[model samples]
Target: MNDITVFPTIDDIMAAHQRIQPFIHRTPILTSEAINQIAGCEIYFKCENFQKVGAFKARGAANAVMKLTEEQKVNGVATHSSGNHAAALARAASVAGIKSYIVMPSNAPEIKKKAVAGYGGEIIECEPTLIARETTLKEVVARTGAVFIPPYDYLDVIEGQATCALEMWEEGIPFDTVMAPVGGGGLLSGTALTSKYISPKTNVIAGEPEGADDASRSFKAKELIPMVGPKTIADGLLTSLGKINFEIIMEYVDDILTVSEAEIIEAMRLVYERMKIIIEPSCAVPLAALLKNKERFKGQKVGIILSGGNVDLGKLPF
Candidate 1:
């Protein structure tokens, strides 16, 4: 079994990058003159929205699935996610020629459900609660004997996520700060580890939705706070921070900033209008935080990881 207690090292991240390179995209780094002018900073958006599953979850899911032992692969992988991770794992499992069982809430977006189904994953719907999701996942695993691959908490998953930041660093741009949206903290924690390792001077910050600000609260309190009654339009970010992810963030992250719902919607709209890019609300949290605190990042080069672009067109907040 893969050791969950062990933290992934820089070498592990490098190897993960190598192992999954063929399966994932080297998503582009985009910059906008209008956005730069508005924010009073040079911002590079690492466009993971163009990633294989239209999210950075592809990296983590692919890494974890590919690393499974042959014996483990036979029964395939299982996970509980509302959207991105479910689609990502399904796609990754398809690439590995294995089955993927996704336990999603019945309220999960239809687009996400379609994506998972398109990738040949079996969808099991449950009540729209954390406890329900976990309970259903446990039942599915028990019945199918599928190896459970958690959305964010697993070491291999985090190691996979580290490669996204690894790509940003390899681009040779010395960003003064690197930022990502914090939900389960897979992307944020992985980004923190890579930034600290590659450019220790570069501050690593995470942006979170005010409605679901467990990460910010946890960071300030120096303890993992479970998310309760999270209410945000950023549906993908409703999950609580993972234990492994929290530990890494506490060690390497500089700060956690929260942005309001209006700020998130405006930021998402700005990207769509100015940059002509479609980004979900969750992906805009980092930009929203930066825009809300422009004075702090004035004249600095900031790198923001655009987590995904899986928004429902029919239900746009704009």
Candidate 2:
């Protein structure tokens, strides 16, 4: 585990961006007049959906892999994720010419499993439970000497995620608010840190599903709260907030809003209809939250991170 006591600095984040430059994409910002009109706000979408590995997870995975020592690289990298992070880490390891071991739940979407395997990851299937996943990962690491790269808890991962917001800021848009969907809170916390450092006036907000509202609850309680029995269509946002991510979010994020599943699906359909983009349910949470609280953000220039596009198309709600 990384030293969670220390937070990443702007210099650290900048260095991470440089390190992962070759492995990731500088995903474009998109706008839809229709979307802006509906929300009554000028909205800019940071399309990480178009990113390498079809998500921003590539940024953090690449940075963490590149930061590994020669000895560590030889031993390779390992993690447990049933979603984009697993494939991202696998692809990063493949690019770096190192081995990767991904411990995925047996019940993970078949498309996701195939993606990890396609990226050259050796898959280790475990029972569909956190304890099972962690136990399996630990056994794999013990046997293979692979270094564990947590999805959202490590400083390097957070630094890499911060680059997404940094890119948005570099585009010269003076955004009044920046939003990201909170799952494990990697992207949200990183976004908050970058916004606070570069533009403290920019309010950082997070959107979470009503069904999986640990982040919203934790933000209000000002303490770590484990997610229990999350049941949302936003599968990517199901994980509880990490300790490191929670601390940064409490200090930097302005608010967390929860939205209904119907709102999430509606927002997703609107993006697909207006923007002609394919974003997963989790990616739509921020837009859903914004639409739900349109009055609060009226006429404001808002930047929303479209987290990923890696949805199981066959199982899509629309």
Best by lDDT: 2
Candidate 1 residue pairs that clash: none
How accurate locally is residue 201 in candidate 2, as Cα lDDT from 0 to 100?
A: 91
TM-score against native, each model? 0.96, 0.97
Off by over 4 Å in 2: 1-4
Error of 1 at 115 (Å): 1.2
Error of 1 at 72 (Å): 0.4
Q: Give per-residue CA lDDT, model 2, range 44-144, as digits (tens).
A: 99999999999999999999999999999998999999989999999999999999999999999888899999989999999998899999999999999
lDDT of 2: 0.94
lDDT of each: 0.93, 0.94
Indicate the worst ten consecutive residues by lDDT in candidate 1.
1-10
State the lDDT of candidate 1 residue by residue for 1-318, as single tens digits: 564466788888999999997789999999999999999999999999999889999999999999999999999899998878999999999999999999999998888899999999999999998799999999999998899999898889999999999999999999999999999999998999888988999999999999999999999999999999899999878989999999999899999999999999999999999999888889999999999999999999999999998887888997
TM-score of 1: 0.96
Question: Of the candidates shown, which would achieve the greatest TM-score relative to the real structure?
Answer: 2
